[model samples]
Target: MPELPEVETVRRDLHRLLRGQWVKNVSVNKEKMVRGSTSLFKRNLRGLLVQGVKRRGKLLIFSMTDDKSLLVHMKMTGQMIYQSKQTLVGGGHGQPRVKRDELPNKYTHVVIVFGDGARLFFNDMRQFGYMRLVNAKQLEQVVKRFGVEPLSKAFTPDKLRRLVRGRKTSLKNVLLDQRGVAGLGNIYVDELCFLAGVRPMRRADKVTDREIVKLHKAAINVLKRAIAARGTTFNSYRDGLGGEGKFVRMLKVYGRSGKLCVRCKTILKRVKIGGRGTVYCPVCQK
Candidate 1:
């Protein structure tokens, strides 16, 4: 899964290549990938100019000039490739093929044609990703269930403290909860807790005020750094241009289980929390 940073990187790259482009046509190779009726999805998007691309949690928002938006969730193995007149940028799992050679691939699920002979292709082997059309006013309603954006100004230490208050879930589990704070997955959650020196097994309500402040800072800092490095490419994450993110090299403890801790010489330990793999330095985290 392409957590928040990877999703944000894709959003930035897609926004640059897609803005102002008019949607000449919309094609859904896999009908299940379309959220609503196929005809309604095409009718709403075709001929509408793309104004911008934004991201909420792990969802991509394609804002249009007609006050309608296309929300795309690239779950698990979803990839979006853009082929323009001059260049091609592919991101997600699997290698990207040219527009003409796209549909032959088993993973190709959706394609959107632009007026300038450019095409955006969505390929997902898992078929769990989705594309939906929503009115501009309803956009908030669609994403309201998600928690605060970690990168937004609204996510402060005080806010995090209040959110975690009375929660009995483990700190790692709390961070992974989308309803508590969005965009954090197992990778970043472990890294955040490690950086904040908070043990993953520690209950959220047991976290101190100072630890909450550190955890808040760690979350934003880790995400900012990951975004700068393009995001971690562990299993199947890539940027909009089919590029692997460099942050995996900078990872502290996510996948470095049994490796020597950077802060302390203790070996990092791996365990399961909330049914997800977790990594942390036993000596450094406590």
Candidate 2:
């Protein structure tokens, strides 16, 4: 799954290539990938100019000139490819195609054609991604289920503490919960816990105030650094330009089980926490 940094990178690239572009046509190869009524989907988006692109959590928001916006979630194994007469950019997983034959193989689910002959392709090998159309103002209602954006100013330590207070769940599970902190996946959560010196299995309420401050900083810092490095490309994630992220090389703990800890010579350990594989240094994390 593409986490916050990966999603943010896609949002930035799509914003550059898609803003001001008018939608001439919209095609859905897979009906399940369209969230709303097909008639309404085509009617609302066709002929509308894309004003801007923004991201909330792991969702992509394509603001249109009309009151409606397009929301897309590229779940696991999903890819978005942009093709124009002069350039080709693909992001998500797999290799990019610069030629017609190079287009996404059997997994192409949705295609949006622009007036200038450019096209954006949404491909998911597993058919898990989806697109929806919603009134711009209703976007909040649609995404209201998610908690505060981890990178936003509103996600202070107090907010995090309030969310986790008295929770019996493991700290890793709390961080992975979209309702507790949006946009953190397993990899970043493990990395964040390692950096904060908190064990993934520690009860949320057991984390102290000072440790919460450190955890907050670690979360933000890990995400910011990952975004700067274009996010971690462990299995399938890539940027909008179809480039694999370089942050995987910087990982301190996530997939480094049994490897020597960077801070201490102790070997990192991997264990199951809340049914997810977790990695941390036993010597460094409490």
Residue pairs in candidate 2 whose N, alpha carbon or C atoms collide under 3 angstroms = 90-242
Worst 10 residues of 1 by lDDT: 95-104
> Can you give the lDDT of residue 72 in candidate 1?
89
Lowest lDDT 10-residue stretch of candidate 2: 92-101
lDDT of 1 by residue, 101-123 (tens): 44436777788999888888888
Backbone Cα, N, C clashes tallied per candidate: 1, 1
268: Cα error in model 1, Å: 0.9
What do the candidate models score in CA lDDT, each in turn? Answer: 0.85, 0.86
State residue 78's C-alpha deviation in candidate 1, in Å. Answer: 1.0
lDDT of 1 at 50: 90
User: lDDT by residue for model 2 over 1-286, one digit each (tens)?
Assistant: 8889888888888899989999999888788999969777977789999999988888888998868889989887778788887777766654333345466557887889998889998888887889999995688797888889998999999998997799998988899888878899998999998899999899999999999999999999999999999888855455667667899999999888999999998999989986789999999999
